[model samples]
Target: METHKSLSPDPNPAAEDDDHPAARRIHRLALHLNPPQGLHSHGDLRMLACAAKGKQLDVSTQELTEYMRGKHRDVQERVYEYFNSRPDLQTPIEISKDEHRELCMRQLLGLVREAGIRPFRYVAEDPFKYFAIAEAVGSVDMSLGIKMGVQYSLWGGSVINLGTKKHRDKYFEGIDNLEYPGCFAMTELHHGSNVQGLQTTATFDPLTDEFVIDTPNDGAIKWWIGNAAVHGKFATVFAKLLLPTHDIKGIADMGVHAFIVPIRDLKTHKTLPGIEINDCGHKVGLNGVDNGALRFRSVRIPRDNLLNRFGDVSRDGKYTSSLPSINKRFAATLGELVGGRVGLGYSSVGVLKIAVTIAIRYSLLRQQFGPPKQPEVSILDYQSHQHKLMPMLASTYAFHFATLHLVEKYSEMKKSHDEQLVGDVHALSAGLKAYVTSFTAKSLSICREACGGHGYAAVNRFGSLRNDHDIFQTFEGDNTVLLQQVAGDLLKQYQQKFQGGTFAVTWNYLRESMNAYLSQPNPVTSRWESEDHLRDPKFQLDAFRYRTSRLLQSAAMRLRKHSKTLGSFGAWNRCLNHLLTLAESHIESVILEKFIEAIKRYILVSALEGGSFAIHKLTEYLSFQVRNIARELVDAFDLPDHVTRAPIGMQSTVEAYSQYTQYAGF
Candidate 1:
């Protein structure tokens, strides 16, 4: 062996140039290792047997679970346990769409009737009650999740939010008890995102004291309506309310309004006269949902069937509404349905939790190629796998909190009916629904890829989970349209900041951000990379806020500049991409702020080696933190075995191999 004294002196080329003592110490470590004259004999280098107990952290997974649960634990746990215990839910998805649909329906009816959990009643009393149930069901099966949403959130929620006391008195009990299986008819073939342009007509009739619901063209047919193909007996149909007039224009278009149109007979379950329904057929995912298309051929609904809370038709065939404009009425109607987006966002976050949990747990159990003469190590020990999963885990935690906040805002808005709060929650829900669902859709595919070939197996759930979640991006509202709505709201706030309009609590950040935007970041901030600085919550928040404000201001300027020549809509069209980027940036800022508010400090950092800077000490500290806290943090997600359902994601290697062998039919 080479003697220490005969070894080369420090290869510290930067030793002379470096000023910091730590920098010099790191440089000297460069010469600390030396190779032997020849490879060591097997006897000399062979591993020694010893008891090396794994280190444990002081973190409590239970406490973290409680934190994640917030005030909704009991409700969620009830729902989670219900599905987990049911052997019916544990079965594979090898069944037909009809079987899947019937199974989903069975699960839904059991939840409501057998479990005696009326999520509909909780819609007004406590929104989290319903939200918790929705999220829990979503984690187990996205198809069942969508079925529940269609039944409870969309159909039941529309009645509660948009209908008057009389309308409620007539339908609420039936909707609550599953006596009325209903679907929402909002998205038409031609106009999904633009509810204002929906072509279906609900013409008032003075003689009959009814409204004639008619699809003017094939494009006006209600498409992708859940529960309509096999189960739904009624629909909360959205159509243009046309009232007969004595003037030049024979009728007045009352924009879009909701009416309870009976799509099927409660007894026979037959499609009603003049109402046509066809199955949307097989989908790329969410096949368990019986999605269908509906076309109305002058379907007659009683005048009382109109959900008259927002806009009403009287016996005299006159259109009456408290909202002053057609636009305000439409806004009010959709505002009530914001709960759909809220529930969707919350459920999407839960789906992501399942994916991240499965991916991380499997990564821990999986062993792959190793260095020469060493045993295979857990995939999670590899930096590539960590990079794939840790950020996703972090974001899931953030989204969990942020989506809960949206629920809170929505609940408060519904109760108070505060106009400003309503606007804030609408925009917030829309942006979050778009951003979170898009992320989950993309992250599912990534999680699939991360697990390698095993992820390809349907039993492992990544393929099915990803496919089911893919539709979340376009349903409720298309992501592109939703983001534009958010950007429009942001610009409205920006203008309000100048027009002397008082900022609501939510938009107040915009005013402060605008002020901060006038000044540039200091040189230190511009070049900030210190470990402490990077981890500081204040620094992270300020950076996000500044980025959002800068985007908002710049996007506004671009629109203004283009408007000089192109006109308003043309200018908006020209700046569409920039506006979308601004919308997403704003949403990211909000999510980051919420996450920072809820979390305590702990993170890892990476750096590229370069000019004589001292980072080794910092790097070592971060490495130790990862080994200490990373595993426990992931464990805190605490997905039940049924939820994960992956062979390699189980607790022990035996369990994994057994499950894999069983799955392989060996």
Candidate 2:
């Protein structure tokens, strides 16, 4: 193991002089930002405490660290034992055949009773309310956790609101009580991302007053469905609604609808007569989740099974929908998926928060090289160390703030039923989820390295956190796929402006963009001047607004021009590059702006208290830290280290040595 010597920059006489305008300005900004107080705050940190508590096991941080250091077999055994021993702490309710389903439901309900949190009430609380309940059920694994969380969050509240009184009466209570574990099966093996191309069909059967659900081929089977393999008895399956006539074929033939299909027997845990289930097998991470594939062979469900928020059918085979446009209807259904993306982003934040805490705490305690004549200094004192870790710390804070803002926006949009706002939320959520998860993957690894060899040790939590977060980038929707959506939306906005002939708007955007590009080279260094610029509030606000607008406009132009030279598929392929760039820029702008706002509002408020004065100092330090690491973090997004450095970025021996020095203080 090798350790780098910590270098303390020589104090500038000018910086020490309080009377100096630069020093005063820096101090003022710090006071204004109101940084974090001592290590603890507001009755233990919400992020860490929540995550630690979610594991259900009362193991201390040290115990967790030791567990990680032990053999893989030992770790797995402990993990399973911890979960199985406390069925009361976490429930594993599965809905299958009559007997098995009833037994599991009773077991789950008993656990719920022990927790003293009602089924309905749990649905309305944090883990459940926010779609993180899967995290509570430790053995469920990440895949199942995410799937369950998404299903519960979507159906727990909105489903009840959207369904008819009869539909609600039949399933809502059972679902709330975990008496009927349900699967939200939408993604097909052949067309996971391309939902419009789904081949599963639900034809109206007037004779039985039921819809005949059929998966025409192997591709049509529901894949990667959590709980579907073993736990789910019923599923909210999405299929195309094939109307009787071709007159409405273009629209109606392509009509995608949701149905509540029974997939398994309640007692025997057997697949229904026509249904088949296969466990998805092992994955890179999220093993607790029982991801599975399901094939429906002419599965039958009553007409009333349709979750007709936007469209419905009568027993007479008559079709009706308030939304005339099939696109709009599709949007409404797909829009529900946005919550999953948003929740994943927040979860990433939580995970990153833990990583940052571990890295930061480890850095503070672990000492490294110093002058040969002196004691070793904390590695955190090195600029290179700070460069590696602080930006991630800043990013963690940035993501935290961004997620809270997004959730607030989503909550309001849901309350007002604002379509425009909903679109914005969808776009933003997609972009942020892609951006945050991608960065989290990189950032977690960096934190691991920053900790040196200790980071590789399972006990530090970095390895598991990294492994758990690995799936986030690809699941829900792949980052690249989601970014394409963001890019597509931006391109549309660009097309609108171009067609509208908003020359002034276009020129203004270009000019601001140029200014931002130029400003990056010669960032304002005068603390006093920059402080003045930031304090104007309007300037800071406009900076982000302008940056986002310009990035969108520029990317749109590039994509449009690139598309013009190619066919539709080619155009889409070419546009992806530009789209990713723009989406990243937009997400970065949001994060920075949100961080600034949180600092101003929340941090500043605490500064007025005498006991809270240290917070102001911490805020000042973090602000400077952010400024110092901004370029590196941005570089991380643009040119990931993995791409730039071959074996260096791959899991390498360097990371091992780095971790060794960090923890063992070699």
RMSD of each: 8.0, 13.3
- TM-score between candidate 1 and the true structure: 0.88
After TM-score superposition, the amount by which residue 285's alpha carbon in candidate 2 deviates from its true location, in angstroms, is 1.2
Give lDDT tens digits, candidate 1, residues 576-655: 99999989988987887777666643222221110011122233323333433455666677676776777766655568
Candidate 2: where is the Cα deviation over 4 Å? 1-111, 118-151, 154-158, 246-254, 495-547, 567-569, 604-666
- Candidate 1 differs from the real structure by a C-alpha RMSD in angstroms, to one decimal, of 8.0
Of candidate 2, the 10-residue stretch with the lowest lDDT total is 1-10
Best by lDDT: 1
Model 1: how far residue 115 lies from native, Å: 1.7
What are the models' TM-scores? 0.88, 0.70
Give lDDT per model, in order: 0.78, 0.59
